[model samples]
Target: MDLAVAHILSRVDVQGADVLLIDGPSGAGKSTLADAIVENWPAAEKPTLIRMDDIYPGWGGLAAAGEHVRTRVLEPRSLNQNARWQRHDWTLDAPAEWHDVPSALPLLVEGCGVLTRASAALATVTVWLDADDAVRKERALARDDGAFDAHWDDWDQQFARFVRDEDPVSSAKLVLRAS
Candidate 1:
């Protein structure tokens, strides 16, 4: 996996195309690859990791506000009106960000729906990782520490819906398997 990444990096000599998206299903090692790639890149070209989760408001954040708009609301409304929509809140009731999207570029968006039509249209390259369902479930379980069984189940369902609705894998530039 590491060597594969190195090969891709070496061959992709696009100057100033700093953004390289890493996308995949849950537990497909998007984070693992992102970390390794950034770590492996030269200091001048080292990529800064921008997790979609960080840009998003967590359950705790939205639970309290109830009706508040997310910080990222304006960015999408003005940037693109058709982004894939996802908004949720917790007991705190704060409103999480949502978008339904249009193409935007020069930045790598790594996560479940990062490679969808909106992103892929603008991306220079997208890395899609794959693993068997059993492996994916096992990795997901280990990563969540058994604390989000119900949430995980719900997430799985959501991922299915997202994939069915927007098949990002077909558009990826590269398909990789973590194991």
Candidate 2:
């Protein structure tokens, strides 16, 4: 791993009460960075993950159908350190029981739409990871099992809209070079 990059990343100070946003195109190692931060940083200083999907119903959802349109954002009061939530199972399309999601003092809301409208302006620190389109596709494909042709195609379209809105380089406090 890149120890230098990890050290640099650890130094970022969140601007305010809001947690940091790791904004990057898909497959730019968003979760990988979060995992690294958790692993490498001193336990006290490590930023725990507050996954955007964890706040939602399932793993692969921004919003479900008309009934549940980003419910967590609508009720931001419950999202404190003592938040009680059970993330939806996107693949199953079923609601789960309420579980306590301790609000980690320094959290990483890492994902594509994380930098989009819902959570964008609330970010304390916005770190954007830069990589070209081809590289992104390759990385994503590798992560999605062997060859994820259809997944990559759909992702390309979705990501275009997502990136258009976020434009992380323009939006983030710091744009980090991603390998």
List lDDT for all candidates, in order.
0.57, 0.57
Deviation (Å) of 144 in candidate 2: 2.2
Candidate 2 — which residues are off by over 4 angstroms?
1-18, 43-45, 53-60, 63-86, 97-99, 146-148
- Residue pairs in clash, model 2: 57-88, 58-90
The digit string of per-residue lDDT tens for model 1 on 1-179 reads 67866865774543444446666767888878777766666546454454554333452331111112112322343345433434444334344555433323223456665556555555567778878888888887798777545666666776676667667688778888877
- The alpha-carbon deviation from the true structure for residue 109 of candidate 2, after best TM-score superposition, in angstroms, is 1.3
Cα RMSD of all models vs. native, in order, equals 6.9, 4.4
Worst 10 residues of 2 by lDDT: 65-74
